[model samples]
Target: MIKFFKKRPPANLPDFWKTYENCFLEKQPEEVNSVRFVVLDTETTGFDYIHDRILSIGALNLINKHIAINQSLELYLIQDHYNAETAKIHGILKNGRGTECITEIEALKQFLAFVGNAVIIAHHTIFDINMINQALERHQLPKLLNKTLDTSTLYKKTLLTSNVFKKKDHYSLDDLAEKFDISMKDRHTAIGDAYITAIAFLKIWTRLKSKGPLKLKDLLKLGS
Candidate 1:
C-alpha cells in the first residue's frame, strides 16, 4: 500500500480579487498601441519591505500614449509603522491633515480593482513590486500577477550602442525627468512620479519604435 497526500484547496479569494483575477482570463492586448500600461509608485515608511509599510500608493493608466488625469488613483494608507528619518523625504505625517486615509486592506482592494490586467511600469520596478507584494502578504492576499516593466532598462535600450556615452549602471527618476525635460512639480509624491514615468515611457516607446516595428511582446521582454 502507498501513502498519498491530499491536494490543498485554493484559498477563497474575495469578490474584488476574484474579479481582478478574472480579467486575466481574457487574452491580453498584443499591440503596444492597444495595451494598457499602469505606471505606479508607492511611498513607504522605509526601504525594508518586511519592516516598513506603504504610506501611500499612486498610479495612473496610460493607453495609446495618453494619460488621463481622471483615470488616476491616489490612496493614502493609515500608517502603523512610521520612520522619522524617511519622513523628511516623503513628507507624509503619521497624522497628516487635509485628507482622509484608509486602511491597507481597503486601499489594496481598490488598487486591485483599478489595476485589472494592465502591464505595470516603474523606475526601479523590483523595489516597488516587493513593497506591494509584502503589503498583500500582510493581508493574506496573493501577489500581483500582472507583468512589470522597468523604465530604466527601457531607457537604456534607447541609447546608441556607440562608446560615445557609456550607459550608467542605474538611472534615477530625476535623471530621466531632466533628460526628457519633464516637470518635477510633484516630486516624492506617488502620483507625480507615476505621471513622470508615464511620460518617459511614451518617449522611450517613440525612440524604440523609430528603430523598427514594436509589439507588446517586444517590450515585455525588457521588463524587470
Candidate 2:
C-alpha cells in the first residue's frame, strides 16, 4: 500500500530563523506600555501577493511610547522582477543608485533578527504581512509569528460615533498622517511610511488611553 507523508520543516533551518523562533518562547508583556512593538512598512512591485516582489522593508522599535531611532532597519532586495510603473511610485530603480541591495534570503534574515517577537504595526497590516510571508515561503521558511496591529482599523476606533460625524469604512495612511499632524516629507519610501505609522499609532494610543486603561490584549482587540 502506498501512503503520503506530511512535509515537515527542514532540520537544517538557518540559525537566524531558529533564533527568531526562540524569541516566542518567552511570554509577552500584558501591559501595552511594557510590550515591544515593531512598526514596519514594505515597498513592493505591486499589490499581487503571489506575483509581486518586495522592493524594500523598513522597521523601527517602539517601547513604552518611545520610538527607538537607533534600532531601525532598512533593507532593499535584489530581484529580477521590476515594474517600471510601480518604480515611479516607490522611486527605487532596478539598480538602486546608491542603495546596497541584498538577496531576499539575507533581507529575511535581517528582518527576522530585527523584529524578534515584538508586536507588529502597519497602516494596512495584511498586505505588508502577506508580502513578507510570500518572500519567506520562497525560501522554505515559516511565516512570521508576531501579532499585528492595523493603524487604519485602530484609528477608526478612536473616532467618536455620532450622527454628526459618520466614520468612513476605510481610512488611508494619508488620512491618519493629516489627522495626527505628521509630516509627509517622506511618503512613498518604506522607512518614511514606517515613521509616519509610528507617530499615528502613538496618537491613537493616547486617544484610546483617554477612553480607559488599555492593556495589550485590549489594544489588539480594538485593532482586530
Candidate 3:
C-alpha cells in the first residue's frame, strides 16, 4: 500500500485581520440614524495604484450627523516612492513635518482597526477603494469588505432629473462643496477632506430623506 502525504490546512488570518473581519459578523443597523458612517480620504503620491504610494489616510466617524473631531484618524505614512510634481497637490513632503508618519504596514493596521465594519463614504468611491485595496493586496491581505457610499452618486440622486437639466457623469468634491456651500478650508488634506465629505453627506442625506422615508438600506442601495 502506498502512503499518501497529508494535506496541510491553510493558515488562519492574523489577529488584526481577524479582528477587522469580525466586525461584519454582527448585523448592520437597519435605521439610517443608528448606523455608523465612516467618511474617508487618501492622499497618494500619484494616480497609478501600482506605482503610487499612499502618503496619508484621514477618516472620521459620523453618527446622527455628528463627527467627533478628537476621535478622527489622521495618519501619515512614510514613503519610499516620491513624486515631486504632486507634492503641491497633497502638501505631504517626503519627510516634511506634517505629522508623525508610520510605516505602510502600521498605517494599514491602524486604518483597519479604526474603520471596522462601518459604512465607508467617499467622493469618488471606486478610486479611493481601489487604491486601498491595491495597498492591501501588496501586503498580502484580503480586500476591504465594507459597504461603500459615494457622495458623488448620492448627490446626483438629490438632483432633479429633468430634460431641462441633464446630470453630468461625474461631480468633483469641489463642485459639491461649492453647490452645498461647504467651505473648502481643508480641501486637499486627508482628514480635512473626510470632514468635508462628512458634512456633504449629511446635507445630501437631508435632501434624500425629504423626498420620503430614507432607511439605511435606501442609501446603501443608492451607493455603488
The clash tally of candidate 1 reads 0
Tens digit of lDDT per residue, candidate 2, span 82-159? 999999998999886588899999999999999999999999999999999999999989889999999999999988
Return the lDDT, model 3, position 53: 87
Count backbone overlaps in model 3: 0
Task: Assess each prediction's global lDDT (C-alpha) against the native.
Answer: 0.90, 0.94, 0.89
In model 2, which range of ten residues has the least summed lDDT? 6-15
Query: How do all models score by TM-score?
Result: 0.94, 0.94, 0.93
User: Which structure among the candidates has the greatest lDDT?
Assistant: 2
Give the per-residue lDDT of model 3 (tens digit) for 1-224.
Answer: 99999754236767898899999998788898889889999999989978898888999989888897888999899889899999999888878865788998899899999999999999998888988989888877888989999999999988888989999999999999999899998889999999989998999999988988878888889876
lDDT: worst 10-residue window of model 1: 6-15
Please, what are the lDDT tens digits per residue for candidate 1 over residues 53-90?
Answer: 99989999899988977999999998888899988998
Alpha-carbon deviation at 222 in model 2, angstroms: 1.0
* Candidate 1 TM-score, true structure as reference: 0.94
Candidate 3: pairs in clash = none
